[model samples]
Target: MSDMPATPLLDTVDTPADLRTLKPAELRQLADELRQETISAVGSTGGHLGSGLGVVELTVAIHYVFNTPDDKLVWDVGHQCYPHKILTGRRSRIRTLRQGGGLSGFTKRSESEYDPFGAAHSSTSISAALGFAIANKLSDKPGKGIAVIGDGSMSAGMAYEAMNNAEAAGNRLVVILNDNDMSIAPPVGGLSAYLARMVSSSEYLGLREFAKKTIRKLSKRAHNAAAKAEEYARGMATGGTLFEELGFYYVGPIDGHNLEHLIPVLENVRDSEHGPILVHVVTKKGKGYAPAEAAADKYHGVQKFDVITGAQDKAPPGPPSYQNVFGETLAKLAETDARIVAITAAMPSGTGVDKFAQKHPERAFDVGIAEQHAVTFAAGLAAQGMRPFCAIYSTFLQRAYDQVVHDVAIQNLPVRFAIDRAGLVGADGATHAGSFDVTYLATLPNFVVMAAADEAELAHMTYTAAEHDSGPIAVRYPRGNGTGVPLPAVPQKLEIGKGRVVREGKTVAILSLGTRLGEALKAADALEAKGLSTTVADLRFAKPLDEALIRRLLTTHEVAVSVEEGAIGGLGAHVLTLASDEGLIDAGLKLRTMRLPDTFQDQDSPQKQYDEAGLNAEHIVDTVLKALRWNEASATGGGARA
Candidate 1:
């Protein structure tokens, strides 16, 4: 271990104050070292590697310039905060990132004092920093508040809302716009155009300053005329008239990676005592690492990899990821249907739309981090007689709930939503978990909601959603690899408002939904050993609950349990709705609904979380036995089997 290379200068930093102690020259070295550490850490653990590597210098400069913990720094999305975490007393624990009981992948107020406002979602930092600024003003505090947001995040309406409010309020807030020219993938929309304008306006800045000085020397009337002329010229040149109109003191198109340039620029901004300012810093997404720089988006989020070659370890030779399955299925479907188009909110690769985009470039749409736009845009496509498959993560789909209700559902449009990450996402924690989509989407009128038991079912649901032309339909699937079931060669529509019994038994029935059916199967096997036979039923769709099959189970079985990988108001709640309406209590049937408890699950392994939530095989078996009053009889020496 002593023969090992010295720990990076970043590893030496335990807080911002420690970073402040470093010489400006040392910070350059620190940045290089931090970049290496971040690359290595992410290679080992698998996470948002590219974004963090990109921000090493910026992270160092901010910590060195600002009085953190006292002076709040909010990072939008926080995916790029790995270097921030390393600097802020988490260097050692960086190896355990996204693991059970490890440091979070994003900023967490509870995790560190340096992280003033927690964030995982985009377009929230400005709002959060403005809140801190307002609080500071109210409390008579003297520290500055900064929000580091990406150009990608700025595309969202919320970022504009915060910028609008911050500018209007005339608050002491500094918005560091980290313009990396990407958001997981290449960015989209008018904001991208605005950033392009800023990048190309370097010469215009000098001209504007010259014009300003020249205008001051002119007569009063000439000056007024020149001013209007200058405003028009500046607007045409810089394309920042929009931001200026928003009342922010827009600064820079600065080089974010250059320590010499960034340090002084940040120092100037820190001391200027201006109203809300937007400092646009243009940096490469994966600046230091050669592999990441070459394939920035691919390295944006990576699995464990070889640090030397930056080659990710081969996944254990087994089943394919659900994403791959979705991609293959979508590609197969799109080959036949010219009207079938795919849309994603800056997650083409993650959501498996990359294949669709590659195969059918004309039909595939990547709408950037604008989930709301993606939804309405799909609605537009649907209205135009095109079948739009709006694929988005369940958590992100929450951003466009109103659009789902109004633009799609209310209009009875045939916009199919391929909701990915539809359960507890293991490492990214509560913020990224797809816990509420089922409950939320199920409640919407004219919306059909379904969950896949496995990859085959997912393919079938995709087909069903595509063929169903009546209204909006959503099919949700989980994060990891699918069960090793052979996918169908051709897509087929399943009967709506239906479910299937996977295993037939008597005495107890387990009604499982989503990918949790596998665990339910395992539980069924364990219960079989205990002589308590279980009937395992997969309720495919959540919205149109198979009441007939459910009622049949309740009538025949001694006890019934509803299981789903979601929160309270999901499948369990829907079952309870049926139970209440049919007066199952009056019928003297024992019913237990097993779903995720109403609490934010902490950072842990997905399997660990499942076990903790009593959704694992052993726990499911235990729950069944307990519900059957087997434990009570065993305790009373009634000769119950162990």
Candidate 2:
């Protein structure tokens, strides 16, 4: 608390209404204080930092000019909403961001009225804003729908799609393109600022409307030529011809950090009667923060850090992360096989495709924020005899399900899917958790889905997937570090649709999938202590059922339980169906399934999330005891206890 910067000006503002109460001269000081408060809060709690810092002045300007809750402001991706949150009555809980039972890392409509729409994925803000705008327009309401989206989000086609359909909302829709990457427009300066203010002003708009009316009275060809001339002339100077073509009145390339330049232009845009407007504002990522400015991506997401030195707390050394292991192994495999290639959707480092790119830059492709294209592209490559691995985060890959089904699965393409973050991810919460991949992919007819039990198994699976060319195969691994098993020197090519017995027994059987094998082994230890001879088997493949092994274990064991880190309709569901179809259930089979609950989990530690979901070792042991109907008197009776 003592290390926090003094926010004398920001302390007075609790909401946008309070921010509007301040004079125009006081805004510069308020923006400075807001930036400090954001840095301090993120430094204490350790969530997104650079994006929030980049938009500090823009956040202040938007809230100051617009009537917020009534105006309906939506932030694209919501990672930069920290500053927006702090100003909108969540500053008290700022330090609890991404923590258990604290503030979410992204915007939530339920959290506050200020957050009109919630988003975690990119490129959805424009569509959501359009929806709000149209809803208000139809109801004959006075509020506008304002969307603050970054340039990176504009890479997705959804933004343009929304823009194309925005004319229906008339003057109710306003899109602020926050260009932090400086990729779209040229450098912003005094001339551009003056031009932006002039173009958005009432006088300029009124004159333009009058000119349009006069031009409409002329011949159709002449009117069209005059309009194209005017639009292209402005486009050459402002770089907004594309947006103008999408039926929006384009303005700016203004300095986002300059309160003087930002507030006036925004005020003009607010008052103008334009049908649809796209304001381009240029701002530096990690602006005003020396350390973050030097390396924006490093500070984009962070752990708790020192505010003065900008030094983050390092996690203790542990086993290599599953992502890096997959990346390195793929890179190594690509060395011998000329056709081996890696593909990722926007996230190169997050999916470990960056390592592969380093070795085979020509073969590895980093497709920006376009999952559908990435899957189909991989499918195309696979169809032509090249072995392509489409490495993507499980939750993100959901965006390309149609492509996966139509382009790859239906055609039975040999696309190697390296699904990263395949289980519950800590801190990022339900939006980012990989809860449904196993359920979704296992249901596909021509899919081979495998889950790794440890780091070593992951290496083997990666190699195995590289070699397998029969059909579409996917290997999923969890987020964070793997179990510290030594990686195989020469990777093993495991037989398809098979499972291995890790621990042998005669009474109770624990069938594990994915990283939950560790918990299954712990449950075996607890069951052994309770006089139950427990057998723990890592059933690696979720699809194709590992039929022979599952049948052998189900018929022999007194009570068999399937444990997995996926939702309903995964391994447990398949196992239950197997038992039912084989008449094992009619023969008095005492079978139980353990899995994630039918509820979305909030942001918390991975262990706490799993504990809450009741998929831990203790829960497994309890499930086994309950299935056996064990009592204190008959606890040591083993299989006869039932």
Candidate 3:
């Protein structure tokens, strides 16, 4: 229906099997068409673009060579799976990427038989592929587990762990190292491609092995010298001894974008009897598209854009995002508090620490994708009396819970956890949601967990965390733009373990935590119009529970409702537990806890997600009405709990 690019080669094929029928040169043309289609699809939908562009030829090569569906192909992080998704018969739903009830942006097992594994997080592909490879081996299944991992993913300690354990899979595992950034070059195309094949040859493998054994028999000094020389020689040519030492038959450093190079290397690796091989295919991120290639971060993720000029649609100017609020606030605080420092796990920009890094470069640490290390590093800094703010996404913090419990909380160090994306993030979906931080952090002893209801509150809590040097404190805020609430000139230190009543009334008390405070106010307004008196309280601290405030509300109000933008174990559960423990329920208080449902929600609009979670104003009103009616029925002896 649209002026789509003529993809004759691509149109002829719906699956990877169709790719095998095309001529080798035609395959290159198909890759060009696929790249155009990918760019167009992402232009229409605005998902991950740079990553998929970077791996165009590699994806084509793998799918063309390997028998997928039978042979498991796992893409690390799944950001680059768009091209793979298109080739695997998911081309029809490419435009609905990250949308409600559409195809997922990532590879999903439920979406296609071609997707044997699902991935949204980084560095999990190697481990998953190893599992698939080993399981197939144990069951005598005729298939290979091929893992396409990136150089960036290698920075994580988990990738190293998987490589250490890769020997168990024998020759059943195939790891294609999709390296876009590294020291690589060798006189244009064909000659460099030849070196890749030579490095993988049996002659080289035998000679390298022979040299290693021969050198070991020499005198200690000569042995060390010879070993160093051999390593240097191999490193100069192949740059794969590290992988070889880890027990993988290293096979590459090929031109990932060149079909001439990519096809042969991939076919060689596919047919080889070797198990656990690493094919290092060099590529360029955001290849092809001029605008993406020219920009920094390579326009990694984008919004809907004009295809001809490559100008993306910019969001309307509004309040600063919650992430920038945290970053700028932390930076402002760091100016006075000389001890303050910021740490992020490979997400300096993603977590907004880049703003802090700009002014206080010496104080900002980008610890690269190791969340465990980032948490413990912050703890170590805190131990020495340095104020360290460990800025990590709520979902990513799950990776370092052991460190949070052992290193920071157990030691009672004041490592401030600045958690961004604290609620249902829209497009990135359930895997990236910050739904469990309140529940997890509140459960820890000596931990002060606070969720900011607005941008100004975030500033205040940031100040509070800086002043409180007692124990580990965490402040969580959501993903999007702030509520346009005017920021304070200098943040005032909030009273710990306390809450403020925004509106005062007699009949119904609505206790809200985090970003749901606005919805609570709306619900109150709706109730007020219906002649029901409603009171609203912003419970600033999820940990301290605001016991006095909660007790008074519980005793005075006819119905008490707890609401949070987190999962079931969070604010509502804590309030109910507190009310039960204090014996406040003896007054026949009608209590209701509203939270996200038990199941993980799919990617949808933020408003839609909150509605589904029953945290919206309408749901709040419905919940309050239901509680009041239940209380009235009990009073009349018509219905009562056992």
Clashing residue pair totals per candidate (backbone < 3 A): 0, 1, 1
Q: Which stretches of candidate 1 lie over 4 Å from their true place?
A: 1-5, 8-12, 169-171, 182-239, 631-642
Q: Quickly count the clashes in candidate 1.
A: 0
Candidate scoring better on lDDT of 1 and 3 = 3
TM-score of each: 0.91, 0.99, 0.94
Clashes in model 3: which pairs? 171-275
Candidate 3 Cα outliers beyond 4 Å, as residue runs: 183-188, 202-233, 296-298, 630-642
lDDT of 2 by residue, 253-329 (tens): 98889999999999999998986999999888899899999999899999999989999999899999999999999
Top-TM-score candidate index: 2
Error of 1 at 621 (Å): 1.5
Ranking by TM-score: 2, 3, 1
lDDT of 3 by residue, 494-594 (tens): 98899999999998899999889999999999888666789999999999889999989999988989988888788888888888998878768899998
Q: Candidate 1 on 182-242: residue-level lDDT in tens?
A: 4222333344435434433434455656777888898989987887675556455434566
